[model samples]
Target: MKYFIYAVITIVGIAVIAGFFIVGSPGLQRLRRLDETRISDLQSIQSEVIFYWQSKEKLPAKLEDLTDQVRGYKAPSDPETNLSYEYEIKGEKTFALCANFSLSLGPEGNNAAIPIPARGYSKPGFAEVNWNWEHTEGRSCFERTIDADYFPLIKDQKTP
Candidate 1:
């Protein structure tokens, strides 16, 4: 009876640990997917803005500028926190884009931040702009970095 009781206790402990990992995995995957999606969307917008600016010699200041020319056009925002995407234009050829992203791993207090290069959200007819995460700063899983080829002066845009 004693041996049986010990075995049962060990099994229960193992099960509990397994359960935590099982439940947490999906959440982490979702966050990663969300980050990737945001990056892709930003990249698409960036290309459109670059083309538009090259032709017009002026950058747009809002997402609406790309609506008529850009298909499936919808401004991307932070899904988890319901925050707006950020934009800032530098000079005539450079811009910045940012978003407040959420992570499932909670705040890792990671001193390092990941940069999303040549990626940003922009509406057609808008100027090149800079973006950065806001609201849940510590919880953000992604950061912004401009591609030197696209925006030679792209610099780190800090979010409030």
Candidate 2:
């Protein structure tokens, strides 16, 4: 009788643990994955914009302007809709990148990515997570400003 009770307890424990993850819902998980992709794309666009600003001392007029064959860099589009991300130049050194997200990410950008996956799960650390990427569901825009001191214009230094 004791062995039977032990088996029941172990099964119940496993079920409870499994239920916790099941509640997360497969569809919801997919949405989260899409949002993750959106964030990643935005980060890439942001880097490209900053680099352009540093080189030209101004924001690109449009996303296409950031594409560089020499650097082998191309602007990424929305993963779910396969549409171009919205880009708007707000000022000489400021621009906004917009995309639609299916779900809201946690404050720390999906802190639940700790446990190892079947292959190996990895969560972004503090330095990896951009503080500006936080957004609610639906359309969100990340506006960036280029600092002149930090991203100075590239000028050819002429030797006298």
Q: What root-mean-square deviation over C-alphas does model 2 reach?
A: 7.3
* Candidate 2, 3-101: lDDT as tens digits: 999999999999987976866667776777787777778878887887788778678888899999999999999998999999998887878889987
After superposition, candidate 1 runs with Cα above 4 Å error: 1-24, 69-72, 81-83, 104-160
Q: Candidate 2, which segments miss by more than 4 Å at Cα?
A: 1-23, 106-131, 156-160
lDDT of 1 by residue, 70-150 (tens): 456656666666565566676555667666555422234221243344444454555666554322433333333444444
lDDT of 2: 0.73
What TM-score does candidate 1 get on C-alpha atoms?
0.49
Q: In angstroms, what RMSD does candidate 1 have relative to the true structure? A: 10.3
| TM-score of candidate 2 against the unseen true structure | 0.71
Question: What is the lDDT, from 0 to 100, of the residue 155 in candidate 2?
Answer: 75
